[model samples]
Target: MLKFPNNFLWGAAASAPQTEGHSLLNGKSATIWDKWFEMNPEKFNNNQGPSDTSNTYEMYHEDVLDMKKIGMNSYRTSISWARLLPDGKTLNSEAIKFYRSYFQDMLDNDIKPIINLFHFDMPWWLMEKGGWENRESVDDFAFYAKTAFEQFGDLVHDWTTFNEPMVHVECGYLYGFHYPAIVDMKKAVQVGYHTLMAHVMATKAFRDSKVKGKIGIILNVLPAYSRSESSEDLKAKAASDLLNTRSFLDPAVLGKIPEELVDLLSENELLPEVEPSDQQNIKENTVDFIGINYYQPRRVQAPTNPKVPAKMPEDLYEPYDWPDKKINPYRGWEIYPKALYDISIMMRDDYKNIPWYVSENGMGVADEERFMNDDGMINDQYRIDFIKEHLEQLHKGIEAGSNCFGYHMWTFNDCWSWLNGYRNRYGFYRVDLNNHFKRTVKKSGLWFRELVENNGF
Candidate 1:
């Protein structure tokens, strides 16, 4: 049987926006998701949106109890910005009370709380003020982070400034995957730079307050692989990695921008306006650790038309599909567990051997009910196998000198996703939308409990 390091944590991650229902209740202001759904109801699948979550707002106590019962040693969940500071400055009393109680429940259950301050849930008021594009939002976010630290720092120790800040730039600004969807490259750069600035500012707040726990950021770190050994393919892979991974990684860990990334942006005339002192701010406020949310590896080749002006990062590198690659059909993502090993190596060699953890990784399936057995429990053996395979790679990484201390699956309960809605389920507990959002432990969950109890399998 494979084993994990001593005192290693095993749990799941969720977010306030994805798991918390009562999106509009208790003085909670509207986030981009809420406003977007209000305007474009048809954009979401199954006509479901943020309010369709698993009711974690009301059910957080029970969820924490359930997590403890399942032998989860820790949990990662974001505190909704809109809910905490609805107007962006004032702390809503009721929202603060609910979050404090929710976090305390985890502590009482002997579960460590890894609190993330933001997770793609932009407050509507801030979005109206140009969101991250406006530098003022940087100050606004710093204030919000400081407030969170002041409020809950004693009860929670592990804090992350943001969850996948790059998605805010790519999906919302450069691509059309999310709300405020626009395809503007220049604005994407601006948004991205400002996001890094906000992160630094938040990190500064965490340090200035001398909070007791580590501060980090969750990045979707998909290692980019070349399709061929050709120079063009190699260059494509480099560009993809720089834009997608290092853009956030280098600054957060090394406290410096990758100079090559700067050159690429400059050559493409896609550079965002940078303040003269911004680098110093970033360089000084690097994170104590990193959170890797790896779902797949990226394979890229030379773009067919590089001569054309680069409007998007995708315009610079073409995606390549490897022959007979394992794929999660429901998510259409390449399933390459070996990438976890490579990523750990990358961290050890390239990023000062910075401490980190597997913050989010899971497979989502459709119609999970079809896997249910007669005992009313879902026999999700596929998910169990998925976790086993990924953990094997993670174990190899740890053995090979990666400073990975823990592993958190994508979520605890099946959450209400952004656009895909409730169609895809990724959770230890199967959430039956058809049955009053009933929660049942799948076979994977039972296996997970044993894994945690043994510290491995």
Candidate 2:
């Protein structure tokens, strides 16, 4: 039977904009989400914007009680930059007070606070000022990082700089899923470079502040697999790897960009506008750790539409419809439990066993409440099985000497997912969207409680 280490942390994660209610509380201005919801409410499902979510900002004390009940030792959350700095220049005292209380409450409950700096919720003021497209925003983010370290560094130990940098690039750049959406590869490359630069700068800030905790960047790691043993499929898989994984992994961990990316960017003339100082900063200030979020794997073949004109390799596989590939029916992600083990081994071998953690990993389902049967709880046995299977593979990776330290699910409570909204539930505890955000323990939640209590399943 596979087992976990005694010190292995078991808990859940949440972001501010997704969980915290967007209210004009005590002179707090609206963020990008609040502005976006106001402009087009219909864009969200059930016309539900960020207004009516979990309200975690206000209910954090009660939420910690729930965490204690569930046997969580570490609770991961992000401090919203918009909430912290509404004007992008000054620190909001009211926001700082709330966060202070929030951190104190977590520690009071014996829950280690794993705080993240930014979780895709940029301030509306910054968005208006050209967002990450402008180099000034990067400097602004670095300042915000320093401010956070100064304020909460003592309480919060594990500091994650950015949540899923690849997702940020995909949503904010190539795809128009996120704010200030620009569909240009050149702009995406610039955003990617600047984001890495921001991470490096933030790490420097945390170190210079003499913070007693670890600083890392969260990356969504999906091990790319070839569709078949064919050479074209293998080549396509390698290219897809560069596009998705290596693009961020190389810069963050190795303090260098992959040669393939450099060649591709040069060929397409989409290389980032890197200043002399930018290169020096990136090389000097690499992260101390990496937080890997694994869900599934990517299988690819050669590009059928070579004329599509996007140098990024994900575009290359847009044309071919590969058969005999497995996928998750409940959610669109492909299920490859083996990919979890492969990803862990890859991180250990490729990155020289850098200290890493499974920051976010879970299955999402539509209408999870239906899984409830004669009992008054959402039975979610499948959710339990999903996690158990992943953990078994993770244990195998650990046996192979991977430097994984902890495992935190995608969320703590049911919060609003970007684009998908609340339709997909990934939380251990089910949150009723209708019942004033009432939290109920699912079967999986109970199972996790015991898992955490015993230190393993």
Top lDDT model: 1
Clashes found in each candidate (C-alpha, N, C closer than 3 A)? 0, 0
Considering summed lDDT, which 10 consecutive residues are worst modelled in model 2?
A: 313-322
Per-residue accuracy of model 2 over 1-457 as CA lDDT, tens digit each: 4568868888898888788885456445677677877887777777777765788877888899888888889988898887787787777898889999999998999999989998888777878877777788778988999999999988888898998887778887887787656677778878888888888888888889897988888888777776677877776777778878888888788888889878866766777887777667767777778888888777777776564456554655542344755666767776667877998899889998998888988888898867787776888898888888889899899999998889998778888886668888988788887777889888888889989877776
What would you estimate as the lDDT of candidate 1?
0.91
lDDT tens per residue, model 1, 1-457: 8889998989999899999989999999999999999999899998998886898887788788889878999999999899889898888999889989998998888899999988999999999999999999889999999999999999999999999988888899877988799889989989999999999999999999987988999999978999999998999999999999999999999999999999999988989988888989999999999999988899999998775458877678998989969999999998999999999999999999999999999999999879889898988898899998999999999999999999999878999989889888999988877887888888888899999999988
- Which candidate leads the pack in TM-score? 1
The local distance difference test score of each candidate is 0.91, 0.81
Worst 10 residues of 1 by lDDT: 305-314
